[model samples]
Target chain A: MEIKQIAEELVSLVREGKNKEAKEKFYSADIISIEGNGDKVEGIAAVYEKSNAWMSQIAEVHSASVTDPLVAADHFAIGIKMDITYKNGYRAVLDEIGVYDVNDGKIVAEQFFFKS
Target chain B: MEIKQIAEELVSLVREGKNKEAKEKFYSADIISIEGNGDKVEGIAAVYEKSNAWMSQIAEVHSASVTDPLVAADHFAIGIKMDITYKNGYRAVLDEIGVYDVNDGKIVAEQFFFKS
Candidate 1:
């Protein structure tokens, strides 16, 4: 798959709340996910667990939108806006940029940046 | 200026090593620049000082490329790749995503995210 195709599909899946499918299809087995804090979760299994933990805190998703994937060689970025109410009844709109490094058509590294 | 126009020109100026010009033209007077560590420099003058401090440590810039600006309403993102040699003889390639929030055609809040 081309980098754009792979990235777009992953974003589409996530926006649809099909995160498990997105991970299984687009992530490499040794994928490394890096957060804004410079911390990383190595391996697809570990990253999946982290994603689950984040999702578990969401009580309701009000809206979600993913922008078109902007491709730059083997790297790409996507803008995300997600509005939700957390399990604790805290509601907020989360805007973020997700940058990915692709290798052999599968995402090997994914990093996210966002405002606090 | 439109958001795309503002973002593209800023990236172009920075890629050309005219960062001061970029800041003066595109950044609002009260612009807030946020780093990956969540630290921020408020006001244009403070941000300019921060930019200069970073440039002073760079012995040479080997290459720089800024991707096309991705626009989403009043928000935009640009990818940057910079190859540089520092004053201490350390050479590294820096890749980052810069996300900006623009108000009235000037960048008001800028945040950066990258891996360590």
Candidate 2:
């Protein structure tokens, strides 16, 4: 798949709440995931683990949105926003930019940027 | 200035190699900058120092390009690509995504994402 096609498909799956499916379909096994706070995780399994840890803390998701991908060369970025209440009763809106690098039709690296 | 206007003006100044001017005009005094390698700097003076340090290491800039801004809410992102030769005689292409957050018509934070 082309970079744009992969980017669009990932966005579509994410919008439909099939995030895990999107990851399985597009992310490479050796993908490197970097969080906004500078934590780095390698491989798809680590990424899943990190993601699951984050999801487990959310009590409710009031709203979620993702902007269309801004494609440039082998890189693409999308803005993501989510309003959620945490298990600890804290509520806030999470706004961030997710940047991805594609190689051979798979996402090899991903990074998130947000105020921290 | 509106967020979109600030974003556009910053991009324009950066494309013309007037990064310091752009920072002076748009960035807040307490602005925060986060590099892809997890380095963080605060305040306009710190940002200028960091920028100067990076520039001091570059021998020549073969080419540079900045993509159009992708704006969403109080945030905007732009893709940057540069082909450069370093003082150490090494040459490579640098590609990155610069994401910025605007507050009260000033950029409060900027984060860069790139493979490190």
Candidate 3:
């Protein structure tokens, strides 16, 4: 899979709530995921665990949409809009842009930018 | 100017420290600018003032680079990496993604995503 194809497929899987599958297929073993605040999670397993922890806090997923992916060499970015209700009944709509750095057809680094 | 052209030119002007000229040439009179915190600044004049205030805080810009822009219809995004020394002697490197929404060949809205 090329960078663009990998990005598109991963985004499709995520939009369908198949994040684990997407990670299994597209992430490199030594993947590094960086949050907007500069916190880093090293390794694919760590990234998955972080994502799962976040999902566990959501009471309901109202809606989600992934925008067209943008590519620049081995880098790709996708915009995401998600509406969710948390366990505390707080509802929020989040807009985020995720940038993925690919190497050898696998995502090596991923960073997210969003309002918080 | 078309969306892509406008975006490229605006970024070029900014990188050259000609942001005021860029704003005058590319921004719509009724432009709205949104920050990562969801705070909004309305009108071109207001946006210019915001930019000036930010610049005033910087003692020196050690380095800056504007990445290749990505375009989708009337929307475009550019990544910026800036290393700066603030007036208070605090030095920080900031990475930000700026998204622009264009209408009628002028920038009508702009939004920035970054870590504080």
User: For this target, which candidate reaches the highest lDDT against the unseen true structure?
Assistant: 2
Clashing pairs in 1: none
Q: Is candidate 2 or candidate 3 better by TM-score?
A: 2
* CA lDDT of every candidate: 0.83, 0.90, 0.81
Compute the lDDT for candidate 2: 0.90
Candidate 2 chain B: worst-modelled 10 consecutive residues by lDDT? B67-76
**Which residues of candidate 1, in runs, are more than 4 Å off?**
A1-9, A12-20, A23-68, A71-76, A80-116
Give lDDT tens digits, candidate 2, residues B66-99: 9888776678899899999999999989888888
Candidate 1 on A34-113: residue-level lDDT in tens?
88666899999899899889999999999998888876557778888889999999998887777787889888888776
Q: What is the per-residue lDDT of model 3 for residues B19-98, given as tens digits with 9 covering 90 to 100?
A: 78988998899998988666999998799899989999999999988876666556667877889999999999876667
Residue B46 of model 1, lDDT score: 92
**Better candidate number, 1 or 2, judged by TM-score:** 2
lDDT of 3 by residue, A1-116 (tens): 77778888987898888979999998899998987556999998798889889999999999988876766556677877789999989999876667777889898888776543
Rank by DockQ (best first): 2, 1, 3
What would the TM-score be for candidate 3 when compared with the true structure?
Answer: 0.57
Instruction: Indicate whether candidate 1 or candidate 3 has the larger DockQ.
Output: 1
* CAPRI-style grade of the A/B interface in model 1: incorrect
Span of 10 residues, lowest total lDDT, candidate 1 chain B: B107-116
User: Candidate 1's residue-wise lDDT over B4-82, tens digit each?
Assistant: 7887788789878787888788889999898866789999989989988999999999999888787666777887788
